[model samples]
Target chain A: MIRTAISAMLLASAAPALAEIHSVAPGEGAQERLQEALILAEPGDEIVLAAGRYELTDGLSLDVDGVTVRGAGMDGTVLDFTTQAGAGEGLLVTSDNVTLRDFAMENPKGDGIKSKGADNIVYYRIRVTWTRGPHPENGAYAIYPVESTGVLVDGVKVTGASDAGIYVGQSDRITVRNSIAEANVAGIEIENSRNALVEHNIATRNTGGILVFDLPDLPVMGGGNVIVANNLVVANDTANFAPPGNIVAGVRRGTGIMVMANEDVLIENNILSGNPTAPVMVIAYVQPYDDERYNPLPRGVVVGQNTFDGGGYDPQLEGGEMLKAAFGGELPPVMWDGLGSLYVTGDAPGWSLNLTEQGKGLGAAQPAPLAAPAPEAEFDRTGIGAPAELEARLSR
Target chain B: MKFGTASLLAASLLLAGTVIARATPPPEQYVNDAAIMDGGLPRLLSDYGFFADAPAQEPVPEVHPYRLNTPLYSDGADKFRFIYRPAGAQISASGEGLLDIPVGSALIKTFAFGEGKDRRLIETRVLLHRADGWLALPYLWNEEQTDARLAVAGARIDLTTPRGEAISYRVPNKNQCKECHGLDREVVPIGPKARNLSGDWLEQMVAAGHIDRMPQGADRLPLWEHRGKSSVEDAARAYLDVNCAHCHRPGATASNSGLDLRWEQDDARALGIMKRPTAAGRGAGNLLFDVVPGDPDASILLHRMIVNEPGVAMPELGKATVDEEGVEAVRKWIAGMEPR
Candidate 1:
C-alpha cells in the first residue's frame, strides 16, 4: 500500500500541468465560440462539444497540431449545416496528429469532412450525411482526405454524396476500416493513392462499391499495393448521379468492385452480392489526357478466393458495348478490358492477371499483344518490378 | 439656467473638435478588439476619415491605394473601394516576386452597392498583418448605420440591389478568408503582385513612398471590364488568372489537374487548351476538353463558370450565383480563338 501510493504521486507529478478541456454548448455565436476555441487550443488540448444541435452557417477550420476535437456522441452532438451560407468544406483540417471523433455533420454545401496535406490523422465514430437523402445537389464527398499520410478512418458512417462517400485521393498509407457507405455515387473510392488497405467496410445501395482508380494529370500518379479484402459489397444498384467529366461519372450503376489504371492490387475474400452487372471489373484509363508523364494501364492485378453471389442478371450497357456484346445482357463475374500494351518490347508483357484461386465464375479475358515483337530492343522490366520497389516509390 | 447650459455645450464641442482635428496615429502591429477600439479608427461605415477627407466614390480616392489588375467577381456585388495602409515602413520586394509588407500593414476592402442615400453598405474585410501572421477580420454593418462590429463566424444579409434584384450576401468567416489568400496552406496576400502593380500605379506608389522602388520591365495584367480597354484574349486570361489561378497554379490545392492558369503560363496544355480535367465530375458538363479553342459550348471551363450546383462550380467558394458578364467574356474569347 505504501509503494502504490508513492508511484501514484510520482505519475501525477510527471503529467503536464497545461492540459485543458474546453466544453462548448449550442447557442447564439456558438460557431464563433467553437472557432475561437480551435484557434486558441494548444497542443494536446481537447475541445469537447455538448449534446445538442449546433446550427452553423460557415465552415470551420483547424490548423493547430495535435489537438483533439470531440463530441458527446455521434447521435447526440449534431453540427447541422442545412442553411449554410458559405462555400467550401464543412470541417477543414490542415494539421498533423489531429483526432476528430463522436460528431455528426449534416448537409454542408461542399465536402462534409476534408483534411488536406496533414499526416497522422484519425477519425473515429464520426458521421456525415445529407438529411434530405440522395440528390445531385448533395456535397461531393462525405469524408475526404487528400495528399495526406498515415490516416485512419474507423467506425465512420457516410451517405448522400454526389461523388464518392469516402474518398482518399492522392494520399498514402491509409486504412479505412469498419465504415459504412450508402446511397452515394461511388462508395469508398481510393483515387491515385497508394499503400491503402480498405477492409471490413459495408458499401450498399451506391452506384459503385469500392473503386480503386489512378487517373492522369494528378501530382501523385501510379497507385499500387492496394488491398481490398473482407468487405461487404452489396446491392450497389443506385443510379449514378455524379456530374460529368469526373472519372466516376463513367462508373456503371451496379458495379461491386472496380480497379482501373492501377498495379499491384489484390482483391480477395470479399463478400460481393446482389450486384446486377459484375462482381469485379478491371480496365485501363482510356480517356484522352495530355500529360506525358502518366501511365494509363492496369497491371499486375491478383483476384483470389472471393465469394460472389447473385450477379450477371442485368447489366448497364453504358459501361461499355463490348461487355454487353460479349455477355449478351448478362455480364461475367470478372471482366477485363483485354487491351494489351501498346509498346511491344521483348519484356514480359506489361502486366499479368493471376487468377489462381478464383472459382466458379466467368474467367477474365486476357488480351493478346497487339503490337509486333521487337526482338532486338532491350527488355523493359520497369513495369514488372518487385512489390517492395512499388511500395517504396509510393511511400515517397 | 439656459445661458449656462449653452456655454457648457459650446465648451464641450470645442474640445471634441480639437480631438478630431488632431493627426491620426498609426494602427497597432497586432489587431485585437481593444487595440482597434482604442486607436479611434472610424467606427461607422460612412465615417470618411480613415481613407480620405472626400466622399466615398471618386476616381483616385484615398491614401496609398492600389487595385488588382483583374478583380475577382464575387457574385454580382461590387468592391467600390480598395485601400491599404502600411504601418511603419514601405513594403519590400521578395525574390519570388511577392511584396513582403511589414508587420503592421493592413489591407482594407469595402463592399458596397448603389450610390447616394440609397446606397447599402455590405461588409468590410480587413487583412491585418500581425507579428505572428496575417489575420482576417470581417466587420458587418448594422441597419442603423451607426457602427460595425467584428463578425468572426460571418453573417448573412438579405437585400435588394438597386436594379430591384434580391440577393443574399454572405460574409466569409475568418477561416474562409484564408482559402484564396493562402499559398501552400500559409496565409499570405494574393494581390499586390508585380504584374498588378505596374504602370501609373507603380509611379504613384513610388512618389507617395509606399514602396521603395518599382520593378522594371514587369509584365502588366489587363483589366477585366473597362469598356473595350483591352482585347478579348487579355480579358479572358486576366479573368482566369484572378478567379482560378489562386488554386490552379503550381503547388496549389488544385495543382493535381496539371492546369496552370497563372498569367505567366505559356504552355498550351497548362493553359487548359484542349486539356482534359483531372477529376471534375459533373463540373465537366460531359465536355471533353477544359478549353476547346474554337468551341465555347464544348469547353468545360465555360460550363463550370455558368453552373451554380454544389459539385459543378469553378471557384468552389463565396459564390452562389454565376457572373454572367464573366461568362460572356470567356465565351467571346473562346469563340474568337482560331482552331489549333
Candidate 2:
C-alpha cells in the first residue's frame, strides 16, 4: 500500500497537468476574451468554451504555447465561416503545445483551421465541418497544418473540402490519429513534410484519399513519414447522388490513401477498404514524360504489412480492362475483402479485421508522442487500436 | 449564244474541280495523331458521361466468361496504357479483364504504355521500361499492334493517304485494344471507335442517296453488336450524355457556365458564362471563351475539342480501348450548336 502511494506521486510528477474552462458565449468578444486568457495563461491552461457558435471573419490565432481551447461538446460549439463576412481563415495558430477539445472549427472563407509554424498541437473530440448541413461546395480543408511540427489530431471529425480535409504539409514529428475525413478532393494530404505518424484516421468519399505526394522534378522532396495503424480509406458509396456537377468537376478518383513518390514511409496497421477504385495508390511521375522539368526526380517508397480491403474498378462497368492495360502486370484488384491481416469492414460486427500486434514489441502503440523502434513485423494495417481500458482512462 | 454556252461550261468545270480538290487528300498542314488528345484523365471521364446508363453500342452478351480471351492474347502487343485528357478526364487500365491484375492493385494509363510477356499472369514480374504517360497523339493518343498471331488475325487497321492509297496496320502486338471502350475511371471516351463515320464518311454515303432519314422517329437498323436502350443515334447520344455530362454542367470545368451538356441542353445563363470566372489555376481547363457570341473559333470548347497538347486535350481519354472518332462526333456537335 505504501509503495503504490509513492508510485502514484511519482506518476503525477512525470505528467504535465491539465487546465479547464467552464463557460464563455456570444457577447464575449470571445476573440478578445480568448486573447486575454491566452496572455494570462501558463503551461497547460485549459479554456473550456460554452456551447455556441463563434464567428471570426478574420479568425483567431493562438498567441501562447501550451494553451488549450476546449468546447462543451464536439457537435455543440459550432464555429462556422462558410458564408463568413470576412476574408481570413476561421482559426489560425502559431503557437505549439496547444490542445483543443469538444469543439467544431468550421467553414472559413479561407482555410478552416490553419496552423502555421506551430507544433505539438492536439485536438480532442473536435469536429471541423465545412459542409453546409447538406449542400457543401468548395468548403476548404478542415485542419490545415502547414510548416508546423508535432501535431496530434485525435477524435476529430472533418468533412467537405474543395481541396483536402486534414492537410499536413512541410511539417515534422506529427501524428494524426482517431479522426474522420470525408467528402474532400484529397483527404489527409502530407506533402513536402517529414517524420509524421498517421494512424487510426478514417478518410473516405473523396477524389483521392490520404496521400503522400511530391511533384517530381520540382525542388520539393516529401519524405520519411510513418503511416501506421490507420483506416486510410472507404468506397464513396452514397445514396445521395446529386446532379452530375453538384460536387464540382476534377474530383473523381476515390481511395483510402496514397504514397506518391514519397520515400521511407511506413504504412502499417491500417485498413484500406471499399474504395470505389483503389485503396492505396503510389504515383511517380518523372521527367521527359512529364512536362514539368524536375531538378531531381522522386523515387523510393516502401509499402508493407497493411491490409488493402475490397476495392477496385467497377466490374459491372468497363473500367476493368482499361485498368489492366495501363499498369501492365501491376494492376491487380481494386478490392480486397478477405486479405485478412490489415483490412476490416465497418459493416462487420465489431470491426472483423482488427490489429494483431500479439507478439510485437511496440505493445499496441497509441496516438501519443509515438516514440519507438518499430519491430520488423511482416504485416501492417490501417485499423485503430481498441484498448478499452486505456480509452476509458483517457476519456475520464 | 456560243460565248454564253462556253462561259456556263467553264463555270461548271471550275466548281467541279474545286470540290474534287477538297475531297482529294489531307493537306500537309495536318499534324500527327499525338497532337489531338491532351489535357488529363478527368476531362476524359466527364467528356464521355461514363456513369449514366445509356444504350450500349454492342448487343448485350447472353453470357460473359469470367476470363475473357480478348485481353489474354494480345498477339505480342500485350501491355496496359494510360490515356489522359485536360483536367477532369481520364481512361485507366489494370490487371483484370484482358490483363490479369494482382488482386487489389490498379494502374492509371499514361502515354507511356506497359508491356507484358503475359498479360494475364500476376506473379514473378519485371518492370522493363517506362514511357511518357502523357504522349501526344492525333484523335485519341494513337498506338497499334505488331505481333505475328494478331497480324494473322482479322484485326483491320486502315491507313489511308489523301490519294486514296491504303495501308493496313496489323493488330497483333501494339497498344492495348480496349482503348476505345475504356476500362476504368468512370467511363471511356475519345478513342479509335471514332475513326470511322467522322466528317463525311457516313454523310457522303447518305448524301449520295445510299440512305435516307426514315419517315419514323429514328431508323432502328442494327449496326454493330453492342446493345442497350434507344436507336443507334440515340445510343450514341446517350454515350455522350453519360461520359461528358459531369464536367459539362454549369460551374464545372467544361461548363461555359451557361451551356449545359446533359441530355437536355441548358440555357446560357444556366451554364454560368454570362461572364465566366477566369480559370483559377495556372494549368486549368478554363479556356477563356467558348461561345464568343457567335464564333465557334472563339469558343474555348471548340479549341479544346480538337487539341494538340498532352496536358490540355478535350475528352482526355487516350486510346486505351477505343478510338478518336467519338471525339470527332462531339466536335461536330459542338461546332453545330446554335446559341440561345
- The candidate that achieves the highest lDDT relative to the unseen native structure: 1
Interface RMSD of candidate number 1: 2.6
TM-score of chain A of 2: 0.68
Cα lDDT tens digits for candidate 1, B1-340? 2243233334433432332233144333222333323333333433433433223422112234455556787765555434344444677654325676777666667666655565666787776666667766677767755455676667777876544567676777666677677677677777767766545655555555566777754336674446268888878887887788888886665765678988778888788888877656446766778999899999999998987765567787666678777898899999998987
True contacts kept of 2: 0.00
TM-score of every model?
Answer: 0.79, 0.42
Q: Is the docking of candidate 2 incorrect, acceptable, medium or high quality?
A: incorrect
lDDT string, candidate 2, B7-109, tens digits: 4334433432343345334222221122223223221211322112111101011100011111111112222222112222222222111221121111222
| Fnat of all models, as shown | 0.47, 0.00
For candidate 1, lDDT tens digit of each residue in A235-271? 9999988876667778888889888888767677899
DockQ (Cα-based) for each candidate: 0.35, 0.01
Q: Compared with the true structure, what per-residue lDDT tens digits does model 2 show for residues A121-183?
A: 666677877665322334445687765556666778877765567877656666677788777
Q: Rate residue B134 of model 1 by lDDT.
A: 75
Write down the lDDT of every candidate, Cα atoms only: 0.70, 0.41
